[model samples]
Target: MKKYLIPLLAISLIWGCKKEVKKADESKEIMTTEDEGWTYLFDGKSFDGWHTYLQDTISSQWQIEDGVMFYKPDPDKNQGMNNLITDKTYKNYELSLDWKISVDGNSGVFYGVLEDKKFVVPYMTAPEIQIRDYTNIPDFTDKQQMSGAIFGIVGIEKDVANKAGEWNHFLIRIDHDKNQGSVILNDQEVAKFPVNGEAWEALVENSKFKDWEGFGITQNGHIGLQDHAHGVWFRNIKIKEL
Candidate 1:
């Protein structure tokens, strides 16, 4: 009876080990399925797929710490307005990211950014979605310039961003195939506009970009993070190409 008891215990232990392995494999399979068709723009370790606009290397101001891409402001650096941009160009995709800004700080996410020797900055050709400390900035009254607005081109329906220091999530979908562009802030639809065609032109024409040639013209371009000389952090940046 004792010998049989020992064998039964050993058999039970073997079954438990098998169950554990099965659970692990099932978790991995679920994770893989969830991640399918999505590409991470920032790997959370280093800036491998990004660089400074018009430059081959990223500036010292950009740092990867605590799994976040942080813009460490250094007033004495005198680096000018050098933005970080994706090395590859994307035409139609859904981009998701998280951002946080310091008090009274301002920055922007630019899409369809054309990088050229003639163009000094990305804003010359890209359409920006404003990222600012809206709740804290006393003078920021314009809805068109508020966080999640297509900066000056299109305004948000409502302010859905968290306060200055809190993390806000932005899910931007730019699909020229459907001729529609939209911004989802903090899981709410904040802004939507035409991606191209006459309506897009009219929006740009009424804005300050009216005189800026090639502004929002190209369908394929790079995504950019503006350097407004304020402390900003970005994380969980990923994209799904359509």
Candidate 2:
């Protein structure tokens, strides 16, 4: 009986060691993937890498509270074009962020945003990912204009957005190498379209951006956030260059 007990104890010790080793390996793998070419656009402390479109500074309406970057509208002040954009430019990359809108609020995320004086607004040059609380918008049946749509250029494949005031995640990938741009909303692939060439041209031609000369013409540009006079919150903004 003593001999059998000794063998059983030894076996238990070996099994424990093996389990510990497996856990350590899994933790290492997770760290490696998170650090692999990914960068945080917002550090949750301040708006260090962002500024207003066409302006050199950030607007007072855009506030950083706790860890969220949000728009706080001033009823007394006349807010004119307070759109925020990144300081640096990105050509082909994967962008990830979380956003929440007020009840019946509207906003958007833009890419390929040109800051030239000729373009008065970011939408003039960039393509927008429409963001809105469609569930709260009465009688708004236009899926092309809803959240996760490519703003009138392309509609989303599904509507999986959370209700107003609830958080929704977006993983947007723009790959010029593959000539494809995609939007993954709440881990669901909602939209996909061409970023350049004839297919892109056709998409633009059929959309409202057909007359805008700089719209989606350049694959490299700044990313922008719309200030559509509605309350919106953003956080966990990061990017990975592909």
Candidate 3:
């Protein structure tokens, strides 16, 4: 009886160790393949590497609800500059996300954001991908001010933005090596412009951001979302450096 018990215990221990080893191996394999170069800015659960621009912590205007990055503003507490930004900056990368804006709302996805104390808003130092509800937002009347535009630098050639309140996709690519960048909305290529050189300089010179000192000057900076004091949801946020 003692011999049989010892054998069974040994078998159980060996089986347990084998299972643990298998799990570790599986985890390593998945990590290597699935998430090797892709960085999830929003991890679908928490705001791990995100914070308000120039601030150490996230503001009340931004919240992670369920698995989505939600913007729920307080009219009474609204300072109008509580934009959310990434902790780390990237030089050249592919950024993708899904966003839905409230009717008549306004927002933006900004990159190359220089969070300087001299600037009160991210747009002052960063180029923006305008996020607006085209259904009712009347303040911006230019095609360059609509969704997926290089916000004022160039207009979106294609009108691919979905109606407000419906989730829309955005894929923004920056390749400084080729001196080209693109904006794709709803899987359709809508805008392409020279990211550098004389063409880029001319566009900047004529746009609203022309007077801004640091706007589009740096190649690497944080990515951020404009808190336009309205309801907007952003999720499935991720980036892959190019």
CA error at residue 136 for candidate 1, angstroms: 3.7
The sequence of per-residue lDDT tens digits that candidate 2 reaches over residues 84-124 is 99999999999999999998888999988889999888988
Where is model 1 poorest over a 10-residue stretch in terms of lDDT? 132-141
Off by over 4 Å in 3: 1-36, 137-141
Question: Residue-wise lDDT of candidate 3 within 1-242, one digit each (tens)?
Answer: 99899999999999999999999999999988976787889888888888888788777778787789889988788656789888898888999999999987889999888888988889788888988886654454688978899888899766777888899999999877788789899989888988777888999999877887878877778899988888999998989998
Residue lDDT tens for model 1, 22-92 = 99999999999988888999999999999898999888889998899989888788554669999999999
Count of backbone clashes, every candidate in sequence: 0, 0, 0
Scanning candidate 2 in windows of ten residues, the lowest lDDT window is 134-143
Q: What do the candidate models score in CA lDDT, each in turn?
A: 0.90, 0.91, 0.86
Q: Quick one: best lDDT, which candidate?
A: 2
What lDDT score is found at residue 24 in candidate 1? Answer: 100
Positional deviation of residue 168's Cα in model 1 after best superposition, in angstroms: 1.3
Give residue 162's lDDT in candidate 1 (0 to 100): 82
Clashing pairs in 3: none
**Cα error of candidate 2 at position 92, Å:** 0.6
